[model samples]
Target: MSRPKPNETSSGFESPRTDEPLFQPSSEVWYKDGNTILIAGDEGFRVYAGMLSEQSSVFADMLEIPLPAPQATHEGCPLVWISDSAVEMRYLLKSMLDPRYILKINQTLDLPALCSILRLSTKYNVVHIRRRAIEALQHYFPTTLSAYYNARERRRLSSGGVSTYFLLANTCREANANVLLPSILYSCSAQQLDTILDGVPDSHQGRVELSHKNKSAVIQSRHQLAHLARTGTLRWLYSGEGCSDKRCVAIRRRVGARLLEGRSIDGFVNPLSTFNDALVELIDGDCCEACQNAVERCVDNGREEVWKKVPSVFGLGSWDVLVKAYGQE
Candidate 1:
């Protein structure tokens, strides 16, 4: 579709005259036959009104309202100004307009696109798009222990390092996808203390910080999980009951000493992941077969126990509650 020049108004109807500059129509989103032009920020998207109304109840009601006097027009289409970032609106519009944009089975959306689409879909009552976005998040931050381990092993979960957890946590709250919070917040608690408290820099939004309530929750959970890591999850290290082999006993003692001295290979914040690769290799490679089996059983049972406590650790109740609440939604 050909866009109008800056100073040129569309053919038939007079434009809303103002000293403020007109929005630049989005090249990617503009449709020649579209009847409505939705302006978000300084960008205008010419899209079919009927299509939008069919997908979003909020848009349906908004478009039905009569525009008084001279209506705003963009490229001869009726214009409506929306209070959302242009980038976010573009993501939402594409997801709604293109059947393959969001629903593709093999597609992996980056964090920003996922959050933006989820937020707008939730706000506009676009159920399918919102559900798809939430499913993507669940793939990364799953509710079950086995599923989480599977995702981690397959390298499907992207933490985006420590900073991204803060962004994801806030987005989950905004979209009301609270079921993803336990794993997301656990990732937040895994970061360094100062990093958690000071927040992290985001490319688009300067710095992102958790809400005060969540900040406290993660910090407290960090301490609690660290304690559990030593006393509960990794207690096998210090339990002094390995196999009869002297070498295996020595390896266990060395690893236990390191953990006691606060020099653990996996760090101490995440109890559920305390048996990381380094520790796993130490137990599996050098230890006697009986000792290896013992450690495996302990690690499995301990990680599951810690995983079950995760939601409660962050004041989110339990897995059953979260599952029920999300189902009701």
Candidate 2:
């Protein structure tokens, strides 16, 4: 709509009267319909319908309200992110809490840089970014996410409406628990897991920390399972997706039968591995078992040193600790 016309104009237009009361300036641009602004000072040409002071307040410790858009070309649709000095406006736009802001951001950003902002948005409490970032991150970093499906960065991510959890889940379902469990356990809740345990029977490890009545029974179940695992009654073997279903209950019966199996209500995670290894697993570690099996053969051939040094091929430092703690684990 056009701005309201000024009354009693003999010349062109007179500025706000100097003697006017402090509260009643003759030409206040507090609202968006004020005719036009010349954009005083040397900031260049533009027309906005709000007070300059109001625009400055959006960045400074001054006013509390926002201004109408000021781009010369689009009028009200200001592309606040185009200029470096407009950083305040950029941040404010990033935090607008509206999903549509992404459309604007996407117009100006590449995928990786976009993902970074999406994550930043989540960290800054921008709700829409939590999900958008996950999708983009997983799409590009799928293997990393898969191996670390339960890792903190992926936890509650889907819950946050990111929906990219499936990307990680698809790739992580088959890895060895001993090798991949720590990454998954890093950020997930007790219930958010199980995809990682695929075929393994519930260890009494299911504590009822949050839900009391059921915690003890679950714990008992896990401890029994872990006991069987520890005693070799439950020989772990890979069968694709999760745990092997065939001899699972049989193992439970043979070993955990005498003792109630249970573990801490919370699932356990081991010490973490290298950043690259961890990221690789979380993204996609489906072939890890086969890879290790080959390495074992090399070690059995009296090539332990050769096998240990193999990690250096992937730019790793040492496997001494891995061999010492859970060799071939």
Q: Best candidate per lDDT, number?
A: 1
Residues 150-241 of candidate 2 have per-residue lDDT tens digits of 33443343322222222222222221112222222222222333532332222222321212212232333343333323323112122222
Compared with the true structure, what per-residue lDDT tens digits does model 1 show for residues 124-187? 9998888888888777789998887777633334445455678778778777788999988887
lDDT of each: 0.77, 0.31
lDDT of 2: 0.31
Give residue 250's error in model 2 in angstroms.
42
- To one decimal, what is the Cα RMSD in angstroms of model 1 from the true structure? 4.9
- Cα deviation at 95, candidate 2, in Å, is 9.3
Q: Cα RMSD to native, each candidate?
A: 4.9, 19.3
Alpha carbon deviation, residue 19, candidate 1 (Å): 6.0
Best by TM-score: 1
> For model 2, where is the 10-residue window of minimal lDDT?
175-184
Position 106, candidate 1: lDDT: 24
- What TM-score, computed on C-alpha atoms, does each candidate reach? 0.84, 0.22
